[model samples]
Target chain A: MSTIPAELRFAESHEWARQEGDLIVVGISDHAQEALGDVVFVELPEVGKVFAAAGDQAGVVESVKAASDIYSPVAGEVVEVNEALADGPEALNEAPYDSWIFKVKPANAADLGKLLDAAGYKALIGE
Target chain B: MGQRTPLFDLHLALGAKLVDFGGWDMPLHYGSQVEEHHQVRRDCGIFDVSHMHVLDVSGSQAKPWLQHLLANDVGRLQQTGQALYSAMLDTHGGIVDDMIVYQTDEGYRLVVNAATGDKDLAWMNANLAGYDVRIKHRSELAMLAIQGPNARQKIGELVNQERTALIHTLRPFEGQQEGEWFIARTGYTGEDGLEIILPATEACAFFNDMVGAGISPIGLGARDTLRLEAGMNLYGQEIDEQVSPLTSNMAWTVAWMPEDRTFIGRAALEAERVRGITSKLVGLVLEERGVLRAHQVVRIAEVGEGEITSGSFSPTLSKSIALARVPMATADRAEVEIRGKWYPVRVVRPAFVRHGKALI
Candidate 1:
């Protein structure tokens, strides 16, 4: 019974994106966090690391159970990384929506529309 | 469909995430796996280990029958309720299974791993030609492992007066029977705790009572991490049908005394000892942020390639640790490959933490 916020756009891989000015803030969805169990470590991309649309290994999020790759929602260059998660990885488990992993400046702004909306994301997770 | 344990409904009610383990549907975690791990280390937690097989071997030749069945000599268990941990092996010195044998007045009771139940029972039955022992599977029973530093004090408030006195006098690696309940001072988590075997009919009530008393319901996820931190071997991982005790750091569990006495795998083990064991199990600690997982390759430069058997994030130390079987000549340093890149790891004794303290 994980919450899929109506505002946030999502990827099939379980990462969610929210538009924040020129850059979009991204984090794992509630379903992703629940499936990964308690996160013990998070490996975020460097500040300027760029990602492609379909094939990019954005970063790593590791729970006590397993480590999963967080893929990019759309092609973008990482503008900012969440440094607080390095010390307290549990933040993502506590609130997956609020604890953004990294902010990405999209390579093509239209790519955001191609991503799954709230209804589509809910359908993807079978919620 | 997988089988269900007696506590299956209770787990669902507690919001446990159930997974298929071996043929049984069991809990992976109640909610947060890390919280359960910390609870067992810092406070108290209980695990429904009823999936494990319990057998009663009775009759005239029970002692001599077990002597040949297990690698460890059970003759030393002269005192009542004394338990012995031993490995049942095949003729080729391969591990069949590992179990705990407790000597009770009626006969000897053995508790073995759940995944290896059928195979183990088949092996036992195949070797019963000369012995007068009856191997009875106690299907009507359920077991729970109540563990942690404060486990004893918490459980004391729940049981009756006689069982309370019995709990107080219970020593490590021992069991005391009272009516239908058998409480043993043994645990896989390397903590002071009890593994209780009681009638299955009363398991739900007992579980409810313990939870009502604030004992957190633990799942197999934390059970695994706790045992991994304690450096205990998992059946299919560290010591399996193909893995020998000589290389698995379980040679101590095999008794070589009374030279005349021969066990199932003794001959092959003795031959292996003479030839010298090549690969050995050791502990690996990754101080950095990466998580160590099973089957990851370990590169020891001069000693050839080895792999991590079992590994996890150690909640107590907040670092990743693992048990890797490396070359006999390997010492100190090794590198583990994760994804495509290799990272350096330090090798030490197989144990990481025990008794709620960091051993590394």
Candidate 2:
């Protein structure tokens, strides 16, 4: 079974957003990594890049099977990214929750409430 | 929904991530695809290739019927248990399917792709009016490819003493029936190994025995990478109905001897030979960080454009490589467009690794 941290919020697209004080840490869910298979390459957006909403494309993740676009979880600026992922894309596969892709400084931190909770996310994945 | 192979139960029990492959449920990986790729290169690994279609052709006119049906001459397989790699073509020179035909005592056995089974059989049935031959699709058979340097030695210890003694005497690209099993020292990976074909009922038990003997059970995820690293062609990707054998690095397989052998697609191939071959398949090596992939546009300066057919990251070489069909006038250097960005690649022969040694 995929791990769903109760404190974090999730998107239907398999991304999770954990609220940390003011900034929100965003990454793909465990279900997402297992479905993508072995990751061979990763392409992340430049720091300071701005996104209009959670739908914005922030980066790309390519597994041995196929490539998928990583979307932003909230409307914000990309304050920080997991720069270490360039050389070690397998980290995302090892632990998707621990390997946060980027931290977004949302225009309104309350937008995090729009995302689904752990129970809802689990139900969405038919857990 | 898809059909399951004989080893389906074993695969699910081993924690393999199953995927739909040509209407069949097959393992993509047990866990780590990169580690599986390394296992085959360094030691040995077993692949459940039971999804591949096997056809048995036997009759009085089997030899002559195959000579006319295939692009490669079946006349070359004179000795018993010898195998031949040939492409069955349509009248217009399009590739119907690429297959391996083995000359057995009964007649010839053809192992074809699972996706193209129906069309290939239909094509065979349509052309069998004049020739007397019985082609039976052996769906009851399951196949496994035990590949790598130590594959033979490990597999040898599993069978009976009679079969064990025969393994050392077998030659490359050759297989002989031992009771009910057909073992051939041939593989898609550029490594020393054997492809064993046996009845479906006995496959699971034998597979469990091999795995118990410490033979790593590899999945299809690594199979694609291993074949790509070895510069081998995949049926649907590299060789298709739209692509001819001339440009697909299969010219050597076609027979032009005696000037009287009337193989299907010969006239068009001869015509193409007279006109000239414009596109050629070559290997591309990317020394950079980017991974090369299929459908990616290759920018060849002045000589026009091309696209990669098979591409992946080589675990042995520690770099990305690909096989692309480029204009005959193209040179040694080109740039590939990956995710809207262009990267440089070096051109080499369509082979990278052989027997655990790096070629490029």
Candidate 3:
């Protein structure tokens, strides 16, 4: 079983987002980490990088088995990244909840309602 | 429906990530594929290869029968327990399946993939209509391959000395049985290890004992990477009915001697050899940041284009590498197109890394 926090919202692609006041903390879900196998390296979006909501390709993470793109959940300007991931990419595999990739300022604050909650995410995974 | 190996429950208990591989529910990785690859290269790891099919062909005329059926010679296996790797070819000389034949005192034992069981058996039966050989599929058996430099040492500690005494003298491509377990020195990974074939009911216990003995349970992801590093060819990817062994760097496995052997596809291979093979399989090491993936186009400067058959990031080399089939006239360097970017790479013989060290 995966450890899921109640406050964070999840996307169907298995990314989790938490509202930190006006900023949103984004990272991968436990299900995503388990599916990607062992993470070897991470390519995170640069600090202060602005991305559009619909087609935002924030960055990429290369796992031992395959590579996956990290999509932005909402339009935002990156403020900071989990620099610790550069040296310890497996931290995402170990703790997806706390290992947030970046912080973003949502373009539309109300867009958070579109993301899935704990129950919706669980149902999406056929749990 | 997904197929399951005898050790499927054990894999689940160990927290392996299961995936569909060739229609079988096999483990892709336990936790870390990179770590599993390193375990096999640096130390020891065990894989549940029970999904592979095991068959026994016996009778007085088994030798002559096999020589007539397979592309390789079986008479060359004069000693008991000696093994021979060969390709089962169609009448057109295209490979149907690649298999390992073990010479037992009573007859010959073969290990093939489960997917090719019906087709291979049908071919063997149709070819041996008048021969005295009998084929028996041992689907009730399970196989485990414990591979690495330290594999023998770990197994040696677990089993009784008296049981493994005969294993020490067993050479490469040879094996012997101790009680109910048949242990073979032959392995797909280019390292010292044992492939143990035992009854399916005992598979769970053996897996548990091995895991308890500190042998890490590896999945098919590392299996692919390890075999690629060892320069071994995988079925469907390297060679199949669509491709011949000659172009897949498996010419050595083909027996060309004993002109009168009259095996299947002998004449075609001979003609192919005489005509000269146009394409040859070679190894490539990526010089850039991206991972090497299959189906990528390879440009051999001034020579011709090739395609990557198998590619992955070598855990030991800390870079991407691949096996590509390029023109025989290709030079020592090539370029691989990854995501539209051509990266300069060195073309060399396979075996990019072995025994936990980089060989490039």
Give fnat, all candidates: 0.75, 0.35, 0.45
Report the number of the highest-lDDT candidate: 1
lDDT of 1 by residue, B1-360 (tens): 788889999999999998889889999999988889999999889999999999999999988889998999999898779999999999999999999999999889999999999999999999999888898999899999999999988998999988888888999999989888999999999899999999999999999999999899999999999999999999999998898888999889988997977889889999998998989999999977789999999999877899999988998889999999999999788999987889899898988888889888
* Candidate order by decreasing lDDT: 1, 2, 3
In candidate 2, which residue ranges exceed 4 Å CA deviation?
none
In candidate 3, how many Å is residue B124 off?
1.5
lDDT digits (tens) for residues A1-127 of candidate 3: 8757888888887888899999888999988898887777787888989987734888888786877998878787999998898778889998889899999888889877789998888888877
What DockQ, on C-alphas, does every prediction get?
Answer: 0.79, 0.59, 0.47
Please say which candidate is ahead in TM-score: 2 or 3: 2
Please write out the lDDT profile of model 3 over residues B1-360, one tens digit for every residue. 689998898899999989887778999999889899888888899999998989999997898999998888888898778888999888767898999999887798999976777888888888987889888999899999999999888888788786567667667778777777888998877788899999999999988999998899999999998899888889878888988888988888888788788888888887888899989899999876667778999998789899999988777787788999999998988999975778899999887776666788
* Candidate 1 global TM-score: 0.97
lDDT of candidate 3 at residue B130, scale 0 to 100: 81
Point to the candidate with the largest DockQ: 1
Note each model's CA RMSD in angstroms: 1.4, 1.4, 2.5
What's the true lDDT of residue A118 in model 3? 84
Alpha-carbon DockQ of candidate 1: 0.79
Candidate 3 stretches with Cα past 4 Å from truth are: A19-25, A43-57, A76-88, A100-106
Question: Which pairs, if any, clash in model 2?
Answer: none
